[model samples]
Target: MSPHPAPDPLAARLRDVRVDFGTRTAVRDVDLDVPAASVTVVAGPNGAGKSTLLEVVAGTRPPTSGTRWAMAAVAFVPQRAAVPDRLPITVRDVVSVGAWGRRGPWRRLDPAARAAVDESMERMEVTDLARKPFFALSGGQRQRTLLAQGLACGADLLLLDEPTTGLDSDSGERIRAVVRAEAQRGAAVVCVSHDPEVLRIADSVVRLVDGRVVDGHLGAGATEPQPA
Candidate 1:
């Protein structure tokens, strides 16, 4: 990995963001910068738009009206496991979804693609489950599969929503470690969770309250209005 600038990393910038669910505003004029290789954990009370913020940033849910820009490649792992129970695919196959962009239209798997899938499984420590049925795995194992999916994307921006939800302490810690490792690898990782453990791994914090950033970073003098 190249030595990137410490102060300003290639990042995803949201300018003048606003979103609403009917009359209920989920996000209002929220501006944020998600920098590369930095863990920015978002925490807040219920209905704070923790998940919505991540979704908008990932381009899954576009802001009702705003300029959201991602300067580098990005991917998302939703709170729910995306694998279908009856798909009959294997663990390795689950991770390979990340490479769909590089796979030409209707192209079959080649040696290089297979190798990439293998590496993603290895990184998640699920190589042993490579040929195993994806639905047959436990929740922890499925979460790891999702982790591998994001990693396999080889993107500089990764968005994870409540990754540790419903996970035991051990599995949650293991997942947190992977998120930290992602940041150390020059990828910006934003994890949305109410768990303090999630916030502990963040280099910076964005505290949201009722659909707005109430505070920036978890420190003194951070209550100023943030760019949206």
Candidate 2:
């Protein structure tokens, strides 16, 4: 007898998906598949509805039409993360919030969960600021904290919007490393970014224009070196 068929590698699939806001149609008739263990970069000009597409996939916003198939667990880090500067929360405290989906509200973090959080913080290079106030950290530092939080969620699919925006070179590389590592671990990662550093590591590129997917492909051309 033949061996069992391989499982579907996709983490999410969209068919004729559209997103509308009042009179504005942000995204229209889009079909895309997010492959597991790969990095897909969504790139486009302003008002191209990149974020809206991400929202649709993340299930934060229901599509006005079409169908979506997604994994049960998804971790998303939005671009316009308005983390209050005066919140009086520690970095570790903020990152721990990501584990709540598994730990629940009333429960505490187990040793495994704690270890995940710690590892995420260290990977994002925010371990030194673990006890520091979230508001006291710089903008870049705050962004890393959020990224670490998303990583700690331990979701099979991760959606990141402009994860490396406004970060220094070193910080940007750190973010890129973590993102690549996630993809290597079989997470379907979709990121919206214009940063060259981020794009350099993509296994596939989804180009959008006026809320439409103009093109999507794998190994299109030359790419930068991967993390050591």
Candidate 3:
């Protein structure tokens, strides 16, 4: 494993972020910095508030206390994207939505946006499924489509939750490669994953327990890399 370069400007910064649902505290007093051109993995057991923390960083949920500074452009892929099986949408349609952020909701995808869409689908190895109905694809294929969508967005910040969960080893590796490529391209990639294979790609690892960050480390020995 190579050493991670000195971290660049932050994609997102959190200071004492706390998220609470009425009497239930989902996350508490958390502070974090997501740096560009690097992969950061958030890992922990269920109910550890890993997802909740990710949501805060993604700007989907407001924290009860503290400050969060996020980049102007952000893309997020939730653990389980609810793509209705009956929706009349093709793989291309799903990937095209990624460009909606850049082109605006009303504008048709121009040549540049179209090219990005095609490139992203190819990066995820889903170009062959371009015209296929999204619902007809297997779980792993659907996951790849969602990832391709995120990549197509061209956002500065990418947040993904358990992207490899339930995926076969090959499918998982494909996802990891794309994510690493995104980071190398200067996008800050934050992922919530438990799979050691997925975690191995992280330049930094943040471990949470009971809604608080128990360990956050960067570079070698921060996380013990697992064999491929």
Query: What's the residue-level lDDT of 178 in candidate 2?
Result: 89
Query: Each prediction's TM-score against the native?
Result: 0.86, 0.91, 0.91
Measured on C-alpha atoms, candidate 1 has an lDDT of 0.79
Best by lDDT: 3
- Over the stretch 83-188, how does candidate 3's per-residue lDDT look in tens digits? 7868999999999999998799858999999999999999999999999999899888989999999999899999999999999988888999988888889898
Residue 9 of model 3: what lDDT?
72
lDDT of 2 by residue, 1-228 (tens): 112322468788888998899999999999887888889999999899999999988988889988877887899998756667678889999899888887886589998889989998999989999999987888799899999999998989999999989889899988888888998898989999888777889888888999999987664352432321
Instruction: Name the runs in model 2 displaced over 4 angstroms.
Output: 1-7, 220-228
Q: What is the Å distance of residue 68 in model 1 from its true position? A: 0.2
Q: Cα deviation of 40 in candidate 1 (Å)?
A: 0.4
Candidate 1 scores a C-alpha RMSD against the true structure in Å of: 5.3
Cα lDDT of model 1 by residue, 13-131, tens digit: 77778888999999988878876778888889988988899988888888888777774478898887766667898887778887765675446767777677778778778889888
Q: Tally clashing residue pairs in candidate 1.
A: 6
Candidate 2 versus truth, CA RMSD in Å, comes to 5.5
Question: What would the TM-score be for candidate 2 when compared with the true structure?
Answer: 0.91
